[model samples]
Target: MSFIIDDTDIPEDDVILFSILYSCVTVVFAMAVLSKFLTNEFRFGFRSALSLAVLFLGEPLCQFFVKGPIGVVCFAVGCLLVYSILPASHLPVGNKAVLITGCDSGFGNALVAKLDSIGMQVFAGCLDKDGPGAVSLRHSCSDRVHLLQLDVTKDEDIQAAVSIVQAHVGSEGLWGLVSNAGVCYIGELEMISEWITRKVMDINLFGAIKVTKSFLPLMRPAKGRIIIVSSVLGRISFEGYGIYGISKHGLIAYADTLRQEMRKWDIKVSLIEPTGYATENTSDSSMRLKREEIWDTMDEQTKATYGREYLDEIYNNLLGIFKMLPDDLTPVIRAMRSGLLSKRPRERYPCGAGADFVTYIFGLLPIWISDKVTMSMSAMPKTAKPRIQMIQ
Candidate 1:
């Protein structure tokens, strides 16, 4: 027997089903285009989900707020907003000018190479003229890479960079700013020196803001983008990373606020949060251990009271985990490019497998639950006292 349906007798359920299907397809299509430009899956996943949620719920909610054409208008506007914010597939490419800070190593170096490889003009900011990053980029990309001596924490460097951009690209030419330069100091919260804490905040948080503020005026007219390189630590805290975590936490707030404030100007503010990546910093485990040695010496009494055996075990555990984690910087480079080039760029991107999963789980949990989990996972039991104490 053949099934037949009268076109005029279609059920309301069918209509709703069709609408929902169409809506979902549209959202997914938009997200796919966005994912290409976004290098970090974490950022793309969170932002796309949020926008889709709003779009899916918006029209139905409008039905309650208003009736007929007015409600329809509101729904249409909401849809447009969502689409407008999604990254576009056909974003302009080639010869685009970009300024990246902290190109001395790691993400900055990787970004510089990636952008230059794709034929974009890269202006890299290094902490020193003779820094290894500048030397390497200059050796490889040569003319495509312009290494500027920049200390993000210094006002002189910020002003100089602004002038350099205006001169190189003029007002209409510069396209993006990648604020990737930052520092990290890991240790017990109470044991970390006040000087170190302030220094970490200065570079990771304040430096990013300084660079953005200095260049924002130039970007204001052209709707240029700013990509802030944060860390997974910003979203989730861990043992021995208190100061670094504090810096990242500040960035989370800064990036969010900047995103809202810049909406009117059409200047997009995106943040890249990457977990442990193989960079010069992570590779130099010996240097980190040496720093710990100095701290250990300085706080010998505290170390003795706390029990050296326990501290040693904690240190070893941290080192082993760091060694096991992947050190690839490619993901960070991808995320940075996506933030700069995506048609509907996300506000935040989390890089690395561990970073993605951990941030997602932590973000979903209640504050209290997350805190308990972190504490439990990071805690170490006390150990017996050292057999002998050395006086330095």
Candidate 2:
């Protein structure tokens, strides 16, 4: 068949197809960024739906009035171009080697799965050798998941991890480190033993430092990312979380300073502050056990002084609040992946609904007001003054 050049044969269907494809691509890009920033699924879903509805209704109207598909294409291209130029946390890299601590459960476990789904070679460090999380990760990811027994608080464990990575580097190398191992201690700071306080700091803050220091050499001049999994409590303190909050607060400072220190070597340091996650880490069983242990250890005199009823009420309320909070750990995994793979990763990523909201509100408040708010929220009943003995 002989084909004749015919400009009139260009169908309207082609234009429509092009417009739809362009619009969809633009929408995906927009949503990706929104997902990164907003993090709340309900809010993101609603806003996304609203925006698309407007675009669908408004685009046709514009096309009708403007008299061409050209107008729609032009507008779509313009918006897409603007989005392309805007800074986004999503990464382009694929198939990286990643190591994550505390992968026995919770956010670390979730993140390991997510990274594996994205085709990364994941090295999951768990506190338990035969834990359900380790078994699950191995089952889902098969050989792609490497399980290592690790306790971040222990120097020997840290060293062993370093050795493993070094051996792997001889063949395949790591791209990032996710410092997700940490413990929480709830109670009056004064009530907690000095040894327990030290242990909390050792695990939460020092452990991160040790792991980073040990593994950083593996990255060398090429540079790798370090993601510190902190909490919203890091930025703002709450009642009964005095020790836990203090440890995380120290982490914020540590991450910030480390970011600056690592800049010279092109190594990036990022922080993920997630709100309460629905995991055994924050479950009623764990919290109740800890509270009971603390209560049981108290001397009769100490119990009499504080009153058992008051302590019980305070601990119960704290755990209840944590249980009520919804968990969306996807944002934390997203942040971790972005930090590892993005060309320009953000210094800090706040995850979960409450965390993002609280962070924004905290930013808006004055320093004095914020301090007062924290103090008021964490207020406890005053202790009775020591009895004075009169000399006769």
> What TM-score does candidate 1 get on C-alpha atoms?
0.74
**How does candidate 2 score on lDDT?**
0.73
lDDT of 2 by residue, 1-392 (tens): 52332334447786576567656755775676566447422234333454555456655544444334555665566556544433354454455678899999888899888888767777889998588888988888757778998999888887887788666655445678999988886877646666778888998999888888888877653477889989899988775688899999999999999999988888889999987777777788887887776677666556656666667766666676677766777767766777777767778878776566688799799988997887676535434332333434
Q: Write the per-residue lDDT of candidate 1 for residues 1-392, one digit (tens) a residue.
A: 53333334556676466456546645665565457446443344544676767656775665444434455566667666765655555367655789999998888888888888877888899998687778888898858788898999999988998898888887575789988888766557655666767777889889998998888877876687889888888888876778888888888899899999999988889999998866666555753664565365445565654555656665666666667767666767777888888776778777776565788888899989997888776634334333455667
Global lDDT scores for all candidate models: 0.74, 0.73
TM-score of each: 0.74, 0.75
* CA displacement after TM-score superposition, residue 300 of candidate 1 (Å): 6.4
Q: What shift in Å separates residue 372 of candidate 2 from its native position after superposition?
A: 5.5
Candidate RMSDs in order: 7.0, 8.4
